[model samples]
Target: MVDSGVSAAYPIIKNYIESLGRSLNDLENILLTHSHPDHIGCAAKLKEKSGCQIWAHSPERRMIEETDLQFSVRPVPGFHTLVGGSVSIDQELFNNQEIYLEENLMMRVMHTPGHSAGSVSFRLSKDDALFTGDAILLPGEMPIYEQVDEYLLSLRKIDEVGAKILLSAWDEPKSGAEIPSILRASKNYIEQIDSAINTTCQNGKSDNPIDFCKQVLERLKLPVPLANPLLVKTFQAHLD
Candidate 1:
């Protein structure tokens, strides 16, 4: 599976596989796009049940093996503490590395770090698809890149790939003429975020990132609980 979802999702995955007359053990590899709890949550459980090898970018290996590393940066809410558990990485992927799935099927890894330091996107040569996990967000969603410049570069990289199908962890797939718009929207969103930060600064508000993000959120009419922290992080990236 591309992502394991949350821990409670294992049973659902197993059931879906069984419906296809396949066992969970038939699964051989779990390729992680990043080490986010929602994406790598059930990896350990799935590995225990199906003996599948987990693969992720080298920078993400330590986080997968020691999940506490993630929580240390982004503290987990009490309700989500059980969402993810640590798992050993059987293979550490690198940029431009090709993973041969079968005689004719192959996937190329692309190191598209932005949302997180270790974030990556996968390119399926045969299918002409790119699986981007949080490296790009849909329009209107909070753009939370740790490094704005890197994020812009990654978006350019995606545009250069010209994948027929664009798959993201949070948004529906885009294809054909719809694909370029995603890249454009991502870049435009970053510009919009920067503008918001600039406007906040012009208003002579507290220069504190948290306070600046609150004004930006209010200006954008976004909810505080959902958009505050992410905007603050994005503002910090701008500062950096």
Candidate 2:
């Protein structure tokens, strides 16, 4: 399994797996893309039930195992409700690392950090499928990334990898021409936001970060409510 939603999602995930003639115990590993609450919410519950080893990037290991520290650093609304509990990582993954899953089947890991410091994308050799977990941002949604440049570079790396199949957590499974289109769109979205920030600055720059994000969000015609603290980091990325 890629990621377990929240603890409440365990039953839903179990039902889905059972529909395919498998149960939670049949699961072997959970590959975490990042350490976000929504992504790793039910990891601990799933692991407890299945005794499956959790694999994630090294940077995310601390957060995945220490829920309180995560809350203190990246606190979110309803964070406690979203997370099941902390779980230990059996394996810490890194860029260019390859995992042999089965006979003649292997998976490659790419350290595509941006959305978070430890975000990663996995590519399976069986069908040339790439699973990107929040490393690539989508349009029409709140842009939540730590570094603008890292995000863009990760997108470029994903593009260069050139997988025919693109599986993302945010969107439906995409293949063929849709892959490039989505990559381009995600990169363009960053450019658009950067432009909005530059335009806002040209108009008038604010000393406060939240105020500055509000101005940029307004320039982008986004919801005023979108100008929150999480986005403030992304907004600050432009200035930095």
lDDT of each: 0.83, 0.90
Model 2: which ten-residue window has the lowest total lDDT? 224-233
- Candidate 2: misplaced stretches above 4 Å? none
TM-score of model 1 vs. true structure: 0.93
**Cand. 2 Cα-lDDT:** 0.90
TM-score per prediction, in order, is 0.93, 0.96
Model 1 residue pairs with clashes = none
Tens-digit per-residue lDDT, 142-239, candidate 2: 88999888899999999999998999988999999998899999999999999998888898889898898888888878898768778888888887
| lDDT of candidate 2 at residue 178, scale 0 to 100 | 92
Superposed model 1: Cα runs more than 4 Å off = 78-82, 227-230
What is the lDDT, from 0 to 100, of the residue 197 in candidate 1? Answer: 73
